[model samples]
Target: MKFAKYGSITLITFVLVAGIAIPLSPSPQNWLQFPVIPGLEEKARNILYHVPVAWTTVVAFLVSTYYGFRYLKTRDIDYDIKSVSAAGLGFLFCFLATVTGALWAKFNWGSFWNWDPRETSIFVLLLIYGAYFALRSALETEEKRATLSAVYSMIAGITVPFFIFVMPRIMTGLHPGAKEVADPAAISKAQAIADSAIAVGSKTFADSALATVAQMNVGSAVPVVQLKMSPNMLVIFLLGLLGFTLLFIWLLNVRVRLARMEYERSTHHE
Candidate 1:
């Protein structure tokens, strides 16, 4: 158990250092030089930590919702506890991701709140999950609450993919890759031809061909620049993630033990 706890802390530290700190820092050349999209310079740095956190939280919530469903099916309190714990952690990470994204947006798009489709959708997701917790608390009976919450969680989970991917693309938004808009130079001649084949109206074959040629010329004229990372911030972020992970694991273990003891006492009384 001690080793498991320590290992989880170490892994979390590594993830934070590699994922967040190193990417955010501004100096010490030896760290990896991450590639940025052509026009977005320092702003691209947001991709490293922000994207990871958003996706990680999505995964965490999905797992939590899955356990919620399982609890309903089996009437298992353990599953319910696990579901809530994971959801709580997921919520923290989701909020962090949104804040980081907001910072990036302020720098890149000149506003923190743009009501972009992707941003609005994710914000809605946060609200929905927030309501989930509140609804859980409003009920008096644990079993009834868990079952109903599980059903709601499952329904919400069904919309996750749509909100995360599809909804963002259907509208014009400040978010990247929406509607599959790509720099023509990023595609090969053959790929460009393929893209043109299906292109129509404003998105016509002639337009695509012209855009492709223009993109290639522009790209060739510009030189790529890489960003460097600072060591101190990297270490601090690593330590923070490590500390948080260790604390979480310790709390989880304590919760599990307490639940077990409560069950035993209840059994003895019966």
Candidate 2:
């Protein structure tokens, strides 16, 4: 287990750098052919890193909640400790994701804070988990703390999907997959760009494609920018996802061990 944890960490680090360092396209100027998203351009590189971190946060929270549920059923202190450790790491990853996302927003949206639906939802999620720690801290007895924390984690789990995925998609936001974006016209436009970018190799194809979209005097107030990643981009994205997932697993293992040690020491002193 130890070898797997540390060995994977070294391998993942190399893979992550490779994903980030490799240019989006074989031809730098013709990045449009390689999954350089229409509006995002160079900024799309963040997608490789930012998205995986967000996903890891979700996985961590889910694991935390599962352990919390187990603790409730078994009344085991170890399960409670494991739950807290997972949650603590989850919150850390969530904060990192938010920070990276905000930086991306600063470049993409021209502001550090935009109150975008996705951003708002993530903030609310932070508060929900933040309250989890606060509630744990307030309790004096072990049983009370464990029971209430487990209950709160279970409740928070229910809101995870709603906040992270559902609510953001329901309301029109900068995120993809919104109501307006799902329209037929947007899909066709995205397909056209992809087909053109692949068939014709030149900067002009991208410029003309974007120009056509701009000229289309759309009826909607908000512009619909579809994200179409190329095959090369998809490969990098998958590598990043794999690396981040392994990193999360390694970190979670280390964190749980440390938490167990701390719990043992505290109880020993008491």
Candidate 3:
């Protein structure tokens, strides 16, 4: 539909903010300070967009695996291709998610790789998905490869989420929401403030100063600070996102066309 163009524009904007702008913009000096008016801070800013990127990629992978299973059942080569595309996209996002999370951790937790439960789980997910790609390559026959890969995908799918969500809570780790230090309430509240600010704008120098002052005042002089976006950075992020999205769409269309051509050739030969 006509919406595709609009969608491309929106994604480009996001890519600009995430990839280029945020990094160039000034990071909050003290990211951990809680904002008084229920919204403000830098860590919260990262969570707003970075977490979602990671999440979208994870869902993409899962959906790919689902299609892989379907391809095995229906013997549809298209489904197999689609499944691979989704998984490939998923892996890209998962890797991005881990990198972004590492950036967040470095700022908040004082280290990039801490072997925390959350980190470990995601790392394992990366490994398992990597294995999925490896398994696909090891087989020679198209049908056999599809069947075996589908089975492997299903098994990995079942295990990855369990490991990502459930195992972390049960075990001790430095990640947030772990045993003996669970504090979703505080984290959620802080996150809410950050999200609200990011929705309006990113934190600016002035906003940062005001937030710092408000933090020192201890509620007596709480100020309402609005998020500010760097126009240049925003533009750059949008451009990068646009470039990637266009490439993805173009590749998908080309693949579909090739498949159609192959089918027509087979029919003509028959």
The best candidate in terms of TM-score: 2
The whole-model C-alpha lDDT of candidate 1 against the native structure comes to 0.62
Clashing pairs in 1: 27-229
**Per-residue lDDT over 153-174 for candidate 3, one digit per residue giving the tens place of the 0 to 100 score:** 8987888767777887665454
Deviation in Å, model 1, residue 89 alpha carbon: 0.9
Tens-place lDDT digits, model 2, residues 116-180: 57788678768878999999999999989999999998887777677666776665455554445
Worst-scoring 10-residue span by lDDT in model 2: 210-219
* Candidate achieving higher TM-score, 1 or 3: 1
Top model number, lDDT = 2
Q: What is the per-residue lDDT of model 1 for residues 1-270, given as tens digits with 9 covering 90 to 100?
A: 686577766765565555544443233355554433433445554554576567666766787888898897789888887777777777887798789989876554444665667788779778877988999999878687888888888888888788767876664444554444333433344244435444633334344344433444444333222223245434444554555545455555666677667857876998
Candidate 3: list runs displaced more than 4 Å: 1-5, 11-40, 174-176, 180-270
Flag clash pairs in model 3: 12-238, 13-238, 15-237, 16-237, 16-238, 39-193, 201-227, 202-228
For each candidate, the alpha-carbon lDDT, in order, equals 0.62, 0.72, 0.60
Model 2, TM vs. native? 0.78
User: How much is the lDDT of residue 99 in candidate 3?
Assistant: 94
